[model samples]
Target: MIKTIIFDFGNVFINLDINGALQHVRDTFKIDTLSDEMTAFNSLYEQGLISTDEFLEFYTENFPKLSKEELVDVWSFMLKDFPEHRLRFLKQLKSTSKYKLILLSNTNELHITWIKKHIPFYSDFKNCFDAFYLSHEINLVKPNPNIYKFVLNQNTLTANECLFIDDNADNIDTAKSLGIKTWRIDIESEDVTNLFNVKTNLF
Candidate 1:
């Protein structure tokens, strides 16, 4: 039986235009591809290996033409609206207390700041989870087995008892390898509100 429900933050909750953001950056930088160093730095930032100021400094130095504000805007362009129905689904789920709710996301500080500013019900949504693990804050990002081990160990949960829901195939594969059940969400055509209906076998 699944005693816990783990959720991913992006696409699963707030909408994100990841490809659009990448294209925007490519246009802004006049480059077709991101340098390996830039990609590595982004991963480091997500893992909280570097401070936000340091991260920003690297970008500002690399792209001297863009101002700090413009840089921030470019960085946050992927984030879009959080639909109310998802929150309602989460709240209703939480009210049951039938399962432990966990939110695991590979998110950075700047993105979170933007979310808090724009997603008014952020706090309420957070409170619905029994445990909330943000990658930057925890110094651990998903698709990594350590993060999953950490979540399970911290919550004293067995992998089989948890159902991790994420939009990323890599993330879901990692969880499945560890014996955790998962729902690889289809953001383009599915809504989390239909969780029980869609995954009736699990329920």
Candidate 2:
């Protein structure tokens, strides 16, 4: 039986336009793709290896034309409106108290700060999760085996008894490799509110 439900914060919940954001950056910055150094800084920021000021400095130093505000807006372009229905569903689920709820997200301080400022119900959404693990705060990003291991170890959870839901195939694959049940959510057609119906076999 699945005793715990782990969720990804991006498309699985708040909705992220990853492709759109990338395209926007490429067009605006006149770059076809991110350089190795830029990619490295992004990854480092996500894992909290570097502070927010340092991350901002790296971008500003490289892109002198962009201001700090502009850069932040660009970085947050992927984030869109969070549906209240999802929160209602989560609240209902939490009320049940049947399964342990967890949120595992690969995100940085800047994105989180932006979320907190925009999403009014951010605190309520967080309260639904029994345990909240942010990649930046924990210094462990997803798709990495060690991060999954850390969650399992921290909660003393049995791999088979946990269900991890994410929109990323790589993340889902990694979780499955560790013997954890997973749902690779389709952000477009599927709604997380239909979790019980869609994943009926698991329930």
Each prediction's TM-score versus the true structure: 0.99, 0.98
Model 1 ranges off by over 4 Å: none
Which residue pairs clash within candidate 1? none
Model 2 whole-model lDDT (C-alpha atoms): 0.94
Q: For residues 8-55, write the lDDT of model 1, one tens digit per residue.
A: 999999999999999999999889999999999999999999998999
lDDT of 2 by residue, 119-193 (tens): 999999999999999999999998999999999999999999999999999999999999999998887789889
Q: Which residue pairs in model 2 clash with each other?
A: none
What root-mean-square deviation over C-alphas does model 1 reach? Answer: 0.6
Q: Give the CA lDDT, 0 to 100, for residue 190 in model 1.
A: 90
When superposed on Cα atoms, how far off is each prediction in RMSD?
A: 0.6, 0.7
Ten residues in sequence with the least summed lDDT for candidate 2: 183-192
Candidate 1 structure, TM-score to reference: 0.99
**Which has the greatest lDDT?**
1
